[model samples]
Target: NKARMSAAGIVGFALEAAPRTTRAQSMDVLSSQANIAGYKAVLVAAHHYQRFMPMLMTAAGTVKAARVLILGAGVAGLQAIATAKRLGAVIEASDVRPAVKEQIESLGGKFLDVPFVTDEEREIAQGVGGYARPMPPDWMRRQAELVHERAKAADIVITTALIPGRQAPVLLKEETVKAMKPGSVVVDLAAAQGGNCPLTVADEVVERHGVTLIGHTNLAGMVAADASALYARNVLDFLKLIIDKEGKLAIDMKDDIVAACLMTKSREPELTS
Candidate 1:
């Protein structure tokens, strides 16, 4: 049976049976890893522009602090905000989830709110998992307008909004990118999943109307060795529950977490290029 099952199949089964970790524990681990990526993304942006992140009190003149705007309040966004704050950049963040406001504020980052009157309060009170439920079309339009206004004022914008198993919501439009200040940078963390910026091309950094749009795919993979080790540990810990005393595989199909994470259907029958 072991020989019959492919390595990929075994790994997939192991992940499904992995021991459950509390949200707090998972967030802690994810944050630690994301912080490193956030710091590096900023450094990469700065190097690309040949600009200093910190203000210089040189004999010539004083340099202004860079302004960094992070969209989304998940692990990646929060880390980006913290990293930007540490580098002396003014950090701002936005999220559909109202609960994240406190999380952003706790890190000394300002939360940008879109004034859309809705039952978000009631929804938040209910405590839904992951992100707030998707907003109505009108609300999304209003939010986009507000975000676009804010994006124009930011020197660097990092977009990290992602909906599990779904394409990332479009946050920054092409016109918004064009409206940004010359030499401004926009990093889209959702590039791998179709991106949050209309102009973003996955894994490529291209200048659009003078603004730099960086659509980085698999940003975590940039730090491969560490990322791999952390991922391996997560996999190994989960695998312990699926493997018995003799290291034989056992699968429980009824587990909620397992059922939720499993890929159900294939979009196409076969690979085509």
Candidate 2:
């Protein structure tokens, strides 16, 4: 008998597959979600400030455009840059990966470049797929200094640097936040992973040296129902590939990607008569 025909009915199965999507693919979805958060974060920040986002050429006087700084040119950061730019804010962004410079520029955001030499072999080995490699302490210090310098000049800063399964690297120190203009806002997207800013406390807004540090956790979960639906669909699509037509579990262990990502311990042992 064929594998599918012999096997008994299986109601459901789970696999630990790394969502089968590239950075580009994930970015497509993340951009949509982050755009909402980006726009909302700006609006939330604006409410706390005395000025407006758009310049007013009214009878009173000319209002200046808000200076918006985005740290880490990842999907969320790029979306934040674009959203802030559209809202009539001058957007500036920075990233450890120099490759993101063009991406930021394409979205009408200025990319702040910080010079650093990367080891090619080390970069390649540490980089799994398209993800960035972890940097040494020396490189991190240089990057932090550059971010601190630029952050002081901006009225608003949104940080989005994050690494999967690791603590988010600190990009903005407390000293830098203190130097920011009074009433300035910092939204740290890495709050759940210890934040990119020193003052960030997940899900709470705190004031430090006259600057508002927002460390809201699960920015995606802010729009819970929508996020849940999208994530569920992604999971369902991946599962379809592993289940047979009869709906019995048939994992192909020889497949490296499947083997590497699947969580075997989570599954209950099959009870057969």
Scored by lDDT, model 1 comes in at: 0.71
Compute each candidate's TM-score over C-alphas.
0.81, 0.80
lDDT of 1 at 170: 94
Cα RMSD for candidates in order: 6.5, 6.2
Q: Rate the local accuracy (lDDT) of all candidates.
A: 0.71, 0.71
Counting clashing residue pairs in each candidate, in order, gives 1, 0
lDDT of 1 by residue, 102-159 (tens): 9999998999887557675445423345544566777688878888899999888898
Residue clash pairs of candidate 1: 18-238
Tell me the spans in candidate 1 whose CA falls farther than 4 Å from its real position: 1-11, 14-36, 120-128, 253-255, 258-273
- lDDT per residue, candidate 2, 173-250, as tens digits? 988988888989889888888998879989999999999888877677777787777666655655564566999865
What local lDDT score does residue 34 receive in model 1, on the 0 to 100 scale? Answer: 62
